[model samples]
Target: MTTRWALLSVWDKTGLVEFARGLVELGWKLLSTGGTARVLEEAGLPVTHVQEVTGFPEILDGRVKTLHPRIHAGILARRTPEHLKQLEELGIGTIDLVAVNLYPFRETVARPGVTTEEAIDTIDIGGPAMVRAAAKNHEYVTVIVNPSRYSQVLAQLRERGEVDLFTRRMLAAEAFAHTAAYDAAIALYWQREIYGREHLPSFFFLVGEKIQDLRYGENPHQRAAFYRLPGMGSGTLAGSLKLQGKELSYNNLMDLDAAWNLVREFHDPAVAIIKHTNPCGVALGETPAIAYCKALQADPVSAFGGIVGCNRPVDKEMAQEMVKIFLEAVIAPFFTPEALEVLKAKPQVRLVAAGEGQGEGLSWQVRPVSGGFLVQEPDVYDFAEQELKVVTQRKPTEEELKDLLFAWKVVKHVKSNAIVVAKDGVTLGVGAGQMNRVGAARIALEQAKEKARGAILASDAFFPFADTVEEAAKAGITAIIQPGGSIRDEESIACANKYGLAMVFTGVRHFRH
Candidate 1:
């Protein structure tokens, strides 16, 4: 009678035959149940069936195969005298190693239209029982669940004739984690499927795969890495393809995210130039080349060494204009051969080819804090012209209304206390991350100076007082758009009338922090 016996029962048979053959070659007997035994026997490997050991045939549509006392008693038995005597008296063998994997419950329920019966049938009852039995008695019994760990397990068995204590403990921990994640997925799906709960649950289960290790974090001295959700959509930066230049750093990814998100807000040809996670210049045009040039002209100095995001492909003309100014990176859907030829001259610059922008999908925005993280839904609100309330007596003309909408789109992407002054579909000045709304208005007006005369201004939030409107009047701003939710909304509206400014209240605020 062989003292070292291995039990193999699995739903996923990725590398079962080779693993069984290796154990047999190492002089260890194999014990398996239904599907796994069929696979091993077909491969001409000798395997003892669970029915032969337990004297009970599998019943109930093969659900009662491995849940018998003979199987679990062998795995859970200790090496003590009393345990050994009980197993010996019952004619049960000691199962040293157990290899099992659960059914694909997550994949089954994740399909488009999975029904209750199909999902319920896919859940395994005996697999988790066997895995937990082996994991709990890890001091005496070794466990194997993941196929990736097969080669290492066989190497240890061949080298030492048995798994070492350290390997057994490590595998035990991994087995517990594997079962935990599987159960979490089941709980989440059932809660959504049965109770129709969309809010956050009392408990959260997060699983992530490491994308890459960056050079550093926000600073050079700090270490950082990037992780992606298991099934995230392709619209995100993690799914983007890096076609050229070096690996992205932490700061580069942040700036690229800002630029890419801002550029996607436009339907027409548009370009967004971002620096330090703020839009320095943004514009729209009939062609991508013209858009890039106009965006650069908006704030040429700030555009230097910034990231550029284009909604359309980059052609030779656009590439020509891009090379004249030093930029940190460029991202677009595609690039012509001629454009690539000219752009490749600057090897240090990063070039990314992302696919077309997709509409907003169900996703969560996560931010880490000291202890844990904060999760919220993404901001995908659209400000339509019909939703605007003309608060001032002097309504905006058609042209002013067009520029106001453009400025509104751009200002939403900027940081909190943000302001943007625009005319003719191009930004004249942008003030971002100010302490007060009036301070932001002053900085934007100072930059727009002469350009402020006919430009329309857009603010992310309402003006607490009438001071912002008063300053805009002094700066020659002709029109203004804001959310207008303050207690003194009448005061701001009265000041717009005083300046003869065309003011509209969106009744919605976009505060990005």
Candidate 2:
């Protein structure tokens, strides 16, 4: 009987020994290099070193070990008579199975204070070459890259006495994806090192691992899936842990992200209720319970079945108040034991624990266009105290300034043509995604009703006309905050002065389109 050879080279040694032992018991010879060879031998299994087959010592600090012609010729050879004759002439034996995984490049670069030299050293050259060679000749060779596939491959071999062509093709496809993702990570790391993070690369590469497939997208007919981008730190909606409720839908994720992002803007205990990617209510308080109560009062009708986000842990009192209304989901840094018990009655509500509540600064935001994508830096800019200009004759009082700032933060998270009416650290009403600035202002002012008399209004961008200012005045708004870059800034300022309203221009715009 001919000897069947299985070459194994891996960085992650998970399931390596057990799989190799199973192959040995099935009368196959083990071929490995360096650490993999040592592991197999220590497990009381016979192994053949790659250097022994090539009759050449590994040089260049083991960097040139598996790059030899002897290694590639063995894995790439077909089972044809012509290929077999050439292998015999070169004194090379055909390798039936190849198991190889690349070095931990992603993990190495993700470490804090990781130097460029360390990242370069972690890149695997010969590993990718051998994996690709084996995968290309998968009609005759079986290539495995993922350690989790070891058991499945072993089961097939044990049952059929050989791996099927169908299974081999699937493994080959996975092997190529594994190499592609590894290369993409390396490319991005170098791109950041060569040109700073602020610069955009000529070529863009987006890589993510699928976390789950949703039942549907925005609508029932559309398909959707969730993927977690690698190297993005924890405390993100994608990294959140679900403690209860059904699987998250596409809209659930969108609303949860909006709520979480808005709540993170405040240092005090904050709560935000979001529906359809718009905040229906937002407020800050000394405790989460107080914040939840105030936030719910903004627009109780709109808050129904909305997603809730809290910067602090959900205590017993907060949970009790939350259960009174039907909420789609509630995400917080933590949930007290008493709170968890109180929320148990509403098992349908999603309970997500977002660790630490510290949001990472994202560098870029990518959106799909017709053919390709549009990439831009995230809207992370905030106005400094010096950037604020009192355009109106009457400056905002200390109390009005505080509410203006609060409303400004909330407006930044709202969609374009957004307007927010807030007072006493609580949002009275929010109008988002309107076509015209005045239309958005009317929606917010109408919702605020009598409450608008003492509240301040915030606009995401400069009003193109004085109509929005006039609308705010008609609603009895006391103060207004806007980016103030329009050509008609004088008209809006004059209008505010006429209405006895204080208006401030922030010099920065936060347009969420």
Question: What lDDT does the true structure give each of the candidates?
Answer: 0.89, 0.93
Off by over 4 Å in 2: 357-362
- Prediction 2 global C-alpha lDDT: 0.93
Native-to-model Cα distance after best TM-score fit, residue 443 in candidate 2, in Å: 0.4
Tens-place lDDT per residue, model 1, 1-513, is 555899999888989999999999998899999889999999999999998998999999988988888999999999899999999999888999999999988778867689999988888889999999999999999899998888999999889888999999999998888788788778877777765645676766676557899989999899999876544545667667787887888988899888888988889999999999999899999999999999998999999999999988889999999989789999887788899999988878898877664624335577889999888768778967899999999999999999999999999999989999999999999999999999998888888889999889999999999999999998989999999899999999999999899999898898999
The model with the greatest TM-score is 2
In angstroms, the error of model 2 at 294 is 1.0
Prediction-by-prediction clash tally: 0, 0
Give lDDT tens digits, candidate 2, residues 348-400: 99999887835573578899999999999988787687679998989999999
Clashing pairs in 2: none
In candidate 1, stretches whose alpha carbon ends up further than 4 angstroms from where it belongs are: 1-3, 9-18, 31-44, 48-52, 57-64, 79-82, 140-142, 158-164, 194-198, 312-343, 346-362, 370-373
RMSD (CA, Å), candidate 1 to true, equals 3.4
